[model samples]
Target chain A: MAFQLVLPDSKSVSQAPSPLAYAVDRTFFYAAAAGALAIILLVIYILWEIGGQALPAIGRSGASVLVNTQWDVQNSSFGILPQIWGTLYSSLMALLIGGFIGVSIAIFLTQDFLPHSLATVFRTLIEMLAAIPSVVFGLWGIFVVIPFVRPAADWLHDAAGFIPFFSTSLSGPGMLPAVIVLSIMILPTVAAISQDAIGLVPYKIKEAAYGLGATRWEAILKVILPTASGGISSALVLGFGRALGETMALAMLIGNANQISLSLFSPATTLAALLASNFPEAGAIERQALMYAALVLLAITLVVNVAGTLILLWTSRKMAKA
Target chain B: MTNASVLEKPTATAGAAIDCNIDKIYYGKFLAVRDSNIAIEKGKITGFIGPSGCGKSTVLRSLNRMNDLIKGFKLEGNVHFHGQEIYDKGVDPVVVRRHIGMVFQQPNPFSMSIFDNVAFGLKLNRFKGDVEERVQHALTRAALWDEVKDKLKASGLSLSGGQQQRLCIARAVATQPSVLLMDEPCSALDPIATRRVEELMLELKNDYTIALVTHNMQQARRVADITAFFSVDISQGGRTGHLVEVGPTDQIFDAPQEKLTKQYIGGEFS
Candidate 1:
């Protein structure tokens, strides 16, 4: 037998593709590059707008915009203190009211405490309510909330008129109506997000809790709620963001006065409401002032979103470690 | 040994064994498991052997009312634990499960430290003794104390696969449940891990009544005192599972009553 060198077939060698074929997959590379570039440009544009106008207004106004009680935009005197205070106060009120009701509704939905059909109907109603326009809510606030709150305002004014905060002028549509409208607006967001978060808790963990002789309430309190805490926090942050940025509803309901008052029944203006009421009438410096207000609102939203992201990341990391 | 004696006290003789009769139906029509019955003697390990979708897991889940979690699952039968009807309206399933602990197929240690995982049941049940001591004792019983004692505070997920399975077993037994239900506890483990779990099961039988579901016939022979064989009847178009035969492990292996049992033990169709 003649010893002959055996060689591998060239057919298999020819079948293997070059590295460029793997590296330059067209569809994926194009989509990824486009997404990255779009995000970069969006961030850059936002920074430029804020830097060009908002910073200058803030620097010029200094502590007066934050501390002074007056805002006379026509006469070139713009102070945001009252608007800032009103925004904080109303948002806090809305959070307190919405948080309680939303979490309760979420618990009810997840715990099978309601009939399945009823739960479904209620969930649908909430979703529809969420999708309803803010302008419609504002109209409802004007027509219904004002009349309903007038009696309560009268009672507070009669009972505690000596107190500065309760010296209610029995105003038409003001802080109280605005707060109520905001609470209703934020409710569906909080409830829907919280229900989803609670739903994401694994069945096994809940089953383990039940298997350990825990009561239904005990299992929810200890296992379900703790596991879903990060998600719930995100939900609350989302609701707060909505409350902060709400403009049309607040403008329609909040009497549109640029004065800070401790009374719930008094007329007050949030930053959003102020911008909505004055942005159309603003001139050179006034436009810059409105932009500054927008910047502040944007900063607040960014902080909330960043905090929510951090909380979610920390929770997932904790879960991974566990 | 004292703990073993406590578990063996009621069912010292074969006449006093707990009998489980489970009939399960899904949605008013589909039968998941039909007229399944088993006698679990105290302090003995009983294994259910079957193919996929063979109702072994359904029967196991029914022992502790874990089937109640399923939306349309309904059961009509008696599971007598110390002569009490488990399915009675007044009897709480949570309370029943407390006394009849369970270990799932996956090593589902909670998202907590090893110490906390072992302590979970004790705290839930308000077990009012020294928590540390109980956790240690349970860990020791599950044969995981030696490897994990120094790292009790570490995350339970930090353990190896075998160790996590053992940790779950330890957590289940921590509540001092008289009966333990394990649903293919070693199916996810490797060969070495499987052997370790088998050894642990044997040791556990001295102090707990164990009902195990396994697809591995050899594992059934190795660990079970009694073996119940189940098969899905696919002739009806949709699958419905039923128990084919059940008896002492030795009898099932040596002289099976049914041809299917014989074929199964002979490794013909497993």
Candidate 2:
């Protein structure tokens, strides 16, 4: 009976459908559907749980929680404007640096600039960078990146002290070091996705470009890059999201100062860094505030991912129309 | 004077547009095709027809160094265009392709406007002429101007399959290349579209040397002034494709010298 319903046009069956087979099929379908529905519910549950814990702070501060930049513990006034700014600023800077390098690496690997075997080797090595633990990246930044960026930061401070970006001296871990480490940390995500995007461009389209006598750079710059721009842009957006939420490396390297400074050498804090460092030993009000900040980070990441997805869809439609 | 010139049919010049003396074509260690000697005569249409895996497209791509884009693609041969070796150490493949343009099997118009697609080559070659006039001339020659002249700003991908193919042809001709290599240009279109493209080829032969790879025997007989036959040999533990015979289209269709060519044209393998 179930066979008739399921395979209405398949008349080659010699025997009637077994009830056991029908039961198995129904059970498998329900199991898979349950798995899918579970994830959706879990996501909503996480948002609800975080929002519920953050309600006290949200009710106390309201929209001012985002705009105010005070965090005095003795008098009990808490505002996370600097952390919000740091998160956005650092992530954008990282995206600019990492996004350029990542897309260039992707193009170099995918556009026949390297041998096939060498490309595979380099791709594997780049992806392996993602597997390293966040704490290890933090340790590496403290030991390696901090040293490398300090002298340059000091040089810029000395040579071009009039510029706001280089006005502060690099006495310790600062925004420049954190930004450099964060950029390196996000390189794998950007490069891998961009490589996939560039590689996915149909071979036929590339052949058409070359068939017209376009040199390598011409074909790449005029045709391949434009065709893959949507994917690359989305990749950068996702990288920005990753950089925004990065906690350990930024916390270790950003010096955790709670002020906004124009100088790249000034200490700063991010939302993720603030949450990770403060949540361990917080009083009643501060804990709620920390949870509220976590919610903001989640909201920012959610917005970025949604925007990235929309950009992907829009560009694909435009590409299809063309 | 115009009436008398129009009455006279265009004839093939004695000069060879692209001459090839190929020993072997290989992808890494595997021999793909071998032992081909052919010359595309100026002001005529030459067709390369054979069964699948016969390396007709391989030889066509080798003429313009398009195969150089493929990894492990190595050719032990010399392809000369207008008496200059294309595969020499100093000859840039880019310059070779600029002079010897190609149309692929698929109508691969770029993701750009119709006018941009036709002008892509002209811009690459740095043509200092009036771009709009040149684009119009190419479209007119490709027989696509009547259909697409008004919508020149429309995306090339928006057109029908046949129109897109003609757009590719127009793009190829807009560069004013001395030779055009077409690899099965009509296999993707309907009979009517194929007829239109074939007519465009006949009209184009007056100005450009054309080499075509076709699967359809009747299409070759209809449009090609000369046809080259290729067949694959499996006796060597691998399918090695080679040219069998090349002659006038009438001789190839009516009386082929080689048994493989005769069998292929006679529908023995189909």
lDDT of each: 0.83, 0.89
Identify the leading candidate in terms of TM-score. Answer: 2
- Using all chains and alpha carbons, the TM-scores for the candidates as numbered come to 0.86, 0.93
lDDT of 1 at B98: 76
Tens-place lDDT per residue, model 2, B176-228, is 88889999999999999999999999999999999999999999999999999
lDDT of 2 by residue, A1-322 (tens): 4544445666665665589988899999999999999999999999999899999999998888899898776776789999999999899989999999999999989977788899999999989989988888888888988888777888899999999999989978888888888888899999999998787677888999999989899999999888888988999998998999999989998999998987789999999999989888899989888889999999999999998888878877766654
Best by DockQ: 2
Cα lDDT tens digits, model 1, A15-84, are 4345567556776899899999999999889878876787778888865776777777667777788888
lDDT for B40 (candidate 1)? 77
Q: Residue A86 CA error for candidate 2 (Å)?
A: 0.4
Weakest lDDT window of 10 consecutive positions for candidate 1 chain B: B1-10
Q: Measured with DockQ on alpha carbons, how good is candidate 1?
A: 0.44
The window of 10 residues in a row where model 2 chain A has the poorest summed lDDT is: A1-10
Give the Å shift of residue A203 in candidate 2: 0.4
Q: RMSD of model 2, in Å?
A: 5.4
